[model samples]
Target chain A: TQLLEQSPQFLSIQEGENLTVYCNSSSVFSSLQWYRQEPGEGPVLLVTVVTGGEVKKLKRLTFQFGDARKDSSLHITAAQPGDTGLYLCATVPFNKFYFGSGTKLNVKP
Target chain B: DAGITQSPRHKVTETGTPVTLRCHQTENHRYMYWYRQDPGHGLRLIHYSYGVKDTDKGEVSDGYSVSRSKTEDFLLTLESATSSQTSVYFCAISETGGSYEQYFGPGTRLTVT
Candidate 1:
């Protein structure tokens, strides 16, 4: 069983479209992080949410941490080809890192 | 750049052979990690180090062992390779104690036949 569960294991949409990826868990975390990874490379941090009910926006991307700190969501606005990659959610529990079963996003031009 | 690198970016080895993957960082981070990424499994932590000679097991510690004798180097070893161990291994580092601002390396593609 996975500690973090992500929805829409895979997503493919055309440019200019909008979409949302979610990560859910029963346990609470002190902080949640989002990362984007391209093929043949490692994941790059996109954002980190530390507070409950916190919402952070990075240009066209929006991130929200659940009020209970047990879930997170990533929203992409006007998606583009450059946004195509694997999006993963991570958290630290018991001094260890746990990652969600990522959502692979493909934005076609 | 986080200044991380993994040796033998791609390797193919037969079963029963011993294999070791090296992870080196130049940032002199205090925390290092070893993880394996596989389809449907996401990124599972195999081992991590807090400081020199201080290491701990992660969720997937079986069949793998890690050593951290120096601040900049973390090594993962497989006593006897098996086909089930084939996957992409990633090395990550963080300067903070809580895994803050963690960064990953290019990864090592291991093929155990």
Candidate 2:
């Protein structure tokens, strides 16, 4: 079985603070996706990285895929209170996806 | 709001009781999935359907069953509810191809006491 490990299960920082969360696995993945979920709601897809060493940015959020395709990271700059939520990384091998535990972020104002 | 919705947004049941959750989507996607979210476990898939009557087990399929009889509807049932099965259930939909990037529905919070 494939396992994805996520770091910093809990994060709390004041607004404007920058932080990074990581997802790592020993097994290679064809694609990886980032999702953010709020309380009482299902996760929302943020980005998908398919190519190795690929980096994609959305607003203040940046996502990086490792060259080995076994790890990924999400960096947020100038974090705001709106950024508080649970962040999850999912690896897609063929058709199904296996997800990392998750990182919970609290951006306090 | 990916056009997916789960019925009985919140439910409370007792152990050994039978419970069913309903998922409906208007997107008509070919792939549908059911997942459960726990405190530190992220989201674990319980079952997924590739097409009507073409369902398959996921990583965590024990004690649960699912069916997709129509393109727009999928159902998840628990034969005997346990406290361990108490979690938030989410339904996801994706098109047939690509990375199958999924869109999730508002979750159903089930409590087994």
Candidate 3:
């Protein structure tokens, strides 16, 4: 079974602060996906990194897939209160999906 | 923000009771998925359906059952609610072309007391 472990289970920072979350795994994945979810809502996809060492940016958020395809990261620049939520990482395995433990981030204004 | 909608946004049920969660989608996507979220577990897939009448077990499939009678509807049922089953459930749909992007529903918060 493939499992993804996320670092800094909880993070609280003030507005305009920069933060980064890491997702690590022991097994290689064909692809990895990042998602952000608010309270009482399902997660929304942020980005999908397929190739090793691929980097994708979304506005103030940056995502990178490890060159080994076994880890990934999400970095936020100048995070605002609106960025507060639970960020999740998922790996697809032969039609089955596995998710990381998740990082709960709270950006206080 | 996907075209997915789950019924019974909030539910409170006693132990040993049977409860079914409904997921309806308007996108007509071929792949429908059910997931449960807890504090540290993130989102664990409970079950999924690739097409009408086709379903598969996910990471957390115990105490849960799913059915898809049509392409746009996927239902999750808990035969006997347990305290461990108290969590938020989400439904998602992925488009064709083997894309990794999936749209999800708002989610249903189910409490077992």
- Report the TM-score of the second chain of model 1 against its true counterpart: 0.97
lDDT of each: 0.94, 0.92, 0.90
Model 3 chain B poorest ten-residue lDDT run: B95-104
lDDT at position B68, candidate 3: 95
lDDT of 2 by residue, B72-102 (tens): 9999999999999999999999987347679
Structural similarity to truth (TM-score) of each candidate: 0.99, 0.97, 0.95
Q: Which stretches of candidate 2 lie over 4 Å from their true place?
A: none
For model 3, the docking class works out as: medium
Among residues 3 or more apart in sequence or in different chains, the pairs in candidate 3 whose N, CA or C atoms overlap within 3 Å are none
On lDDT, the candidate that comes out on top is: 1
> Chain A alone, model 3, TM-score?
0.97
Query: Which pairs clash in model 2?
Result: none
Instruction: Give the candidates in order of DockQ, highest first.
Output: 1, 2, 3
Q: List the residue pairs that clash in candidate 1.
A: none
- Per-residue lDDT for A1-109 in model 1, tens only? 8989998899999999999999999998899999999999999999999999999999999999999999999999999999999999999887799999899999999
N/CA/C clash count, model 1: 0
Per-residue lDDT over A13-63 for candidate 3, one digit per residue giving the tens place of the 0 to 100 score? 999999999999988888999989887677888889999999999999999
Interface RMSD, per-candidate values to 1 decimal = 1.1, 1.4, 1.8
Top candidate (TM-score): 1
Q: Give one digit per residue, the lDDT tens place, for model 3 in B10-70.
A: 9999999999999999998999999998876788889999999999898889999999999
